[model samples]
Target: MAATPEGYMSGFGNDFETEALPGALPVGQNSPQRCAYGLYAEQLSGSPFTAPRGLNERSWLYRLRPSVRHTGRFDKVDLPHWKSAPCIVEHDRPIGQYRWSPVPIPDASLTFVAGVRTMTTAGDVNTQTGMSTHLYFVTASMFDDYFYNADGELLIAPQQGALAFVTEFGRIGIAPGEICVIPRGVKFRVELVAGAARGYMCENYGAKFTLPNRGPIGANCLANARDFKTPVAAFEDREATSRMTVKWCGKFYACEIGHSPLDVVAWHGNYAPYKYDLRAFSPIGAILFDHPDPSIFSVLTAPSGEEGTANVDFVIFPERWQVAEHSFRPPWYHMNIMSEFMGLIYGQYDAKPQGFTPGAMSLHNCMLPHGPDAQAFARASQARLEPEKLTKTLAFMFETRFPQRLTDYAATLETLQEDYADCWAGLEKRFNGKP
Candidate 1:
């Protein structure tokens, strides 16, 4: 981990090195390879609902991965000089069923999930759950504050616009469709430049995310480590009164802290701020047989407890081939320890059809029972199982270990689609009474 400049320590905090995946994909292999199958096809057309591609187009063909984004103009905004309200609040009024309502962070201790919802319908609400996945989103402003999740890492996904992330180590900008991972306690903030922004924020309160044991898939499959990029050491020696937002025992609070939060004079561990573009993801598949499980596409993961358990897993189902003959082509229904909080950047999520849209979110708590709706299941069942190409759409998840509890703000937002809860209403029970 890189160290923060001299005096920035107390506010910025220290970051540890994340345990590298047991086997990381070699760097600079088949980089920027392009095909008509997944994200590439969508990028080629310049669509907002498309995924971000690696620095090059031919990302998949290369043996190693390429840099996800080319460095751009990164600005350092002096937060102390700007005027703002005291960064703290606790609300009691109920809003609606939308996640991004402006509610005061509750004063009473509570584990509430906070963040912006891009898209959703009733049956599927993407609840941020990685670790104790507590998410936050900023619109048209810079998040010049500090946050802590007790004992978990931070998973940040930006759905729209760009974030000029000014940590102690220089500045890195994450545009749409990009994910930034800040390890536990590493204080940072977001400065939005494009437009209104929203996405997932998971505050993992368990073991950090590590690559799942490939087991039968050998040590190599999805998410090669070298593909992950950590910013070079960048330090800031400025003095200012920045805000700090801490989530402790389920409640959000603010303190009148006066210092930059990206302070880690010097440290070494496996945790750091790394970004990944979904387009660079090399999808492993059961080409001639059937669609493999989503685990096969996990680019980064913060595991929870033991093996097969995850506090949060950042998984994507980008544009890819559908060549499974004589098999159901969409996601199958199953319950898992990790609750799933999903969102779409652009295009359709293969698992659902009509109601799901770009900027929509859905949450399927652990064991709550979820999958393709009845309409999707029926259509996919009768459709031809040919090698159909699914392109343009890019959807992802912030899967977590805890069952997410909706904040009053999210339970009552004006934009909250009231009829969405009925998405699964048409599902049928076909069990015969013969047992």
Candidate 2:
């Protein structure tokens, strides 16, 4: 028996219970008692990570099982049109078909967001997808696998708990406030490493993100490439019953097996798990003149197929100085290749006037035309623009090619602050006589 290490014991002291469905789909029998760490060790040591192909065995650690009743909920909507062209899941076929469709969306041209469901059939399978800018919030404990886009870009932000992210590239124990970006197609798993981890998942289904165009601002302004760190080559192999779930084409399924699915013996690629501490972001802005477009603060961006068109742009406006002499403090009205879905990790966003709180998200479809609310515009226009640091606020935006649709669960979620729509109401417009 392997005894728990003294220091590491704290990490495992949480409420990690197991659901012993001895013979669930793919692998029919429950696997031997092994935590995610044990499985990682076995892979590091050279053992098959799956059950002997023919043997049927399975098990899952569903951390988010019981917390469905406590948290706030989204106001549900009805979006029947999305049922047909839903996304696809090509992994684990035997388990059965899966269903994923956005509950309802305000606009059809923007996005499609939905909860995920899956069943099992065969071996140790992990379903993965390269999704767009729609952030995911799992209402239930998702027994599944994860992967990055084809290029191996992984940027996952969890709202509630932590996840044991295992991959052929490397492994990371992540929680809220921290995010992981695995370049497209780097095989990985989403194991609930801690307590009921109910959180949001944002898939930027946009063009590959690149540095913001320097334009006249010159070089080394926004996001520096050196801040990005991709994982080096890593592999795992072990023979045991492990379940692999895959989400493809919009459905979820599973495959049974008797080996570790994270088996990448010797692979080399630029795509891998890399993260940038938002706090480390270098925020550059106008210290003397009017505030520039938020594009000046973009960290990474995925452009659309069209020139200068962005599929998704991961931009952040962290704590920074505000000293524009005759400028509007908040983000100015604008439209571009991207549809913006904004979230506040913590602190106030300069763009909106009010009601946009932490964890609250708002979407402005491409070309929809939006900007600072009335109250904010009035305040900034009247107040003296002295140099002052707007500290302790970290807001982010998922500017994508397609508009995002909210899940039925998300839209109808009682926790969905009904007052959000009223924020824009405060933005009073003043037309000049010249017009």
| Candidate lDDT values, in order | 0.50, 0.47
What overall lDDT, based on C-alpha atoms, would model 1 receive against the true structure? 0.50
Predicted model with the maximum lDDT: 1
Q: Kindly provide the TM-score of model 2 when superposed on the true structure, using C-alpha atoms.
A: 0.64
Model 1, which residues run further than 4 Å from truth?
1-130, 133-135, 143-151, 240-269, 425-435
Superposed by TM-score, candidate 1 places the C-alpha of residue 13 at a distance from the truth, in angstroms, of: 19
Using alpha carbons, what is the TM-score of model 1? 0.65
lDDT of 2 at 208: 36
Reference-based lDDT, residue 375, model 2: 74
lDDT of 1 by residue, 86-134 (tens): 1122445332222222223223322112333222111111232334333
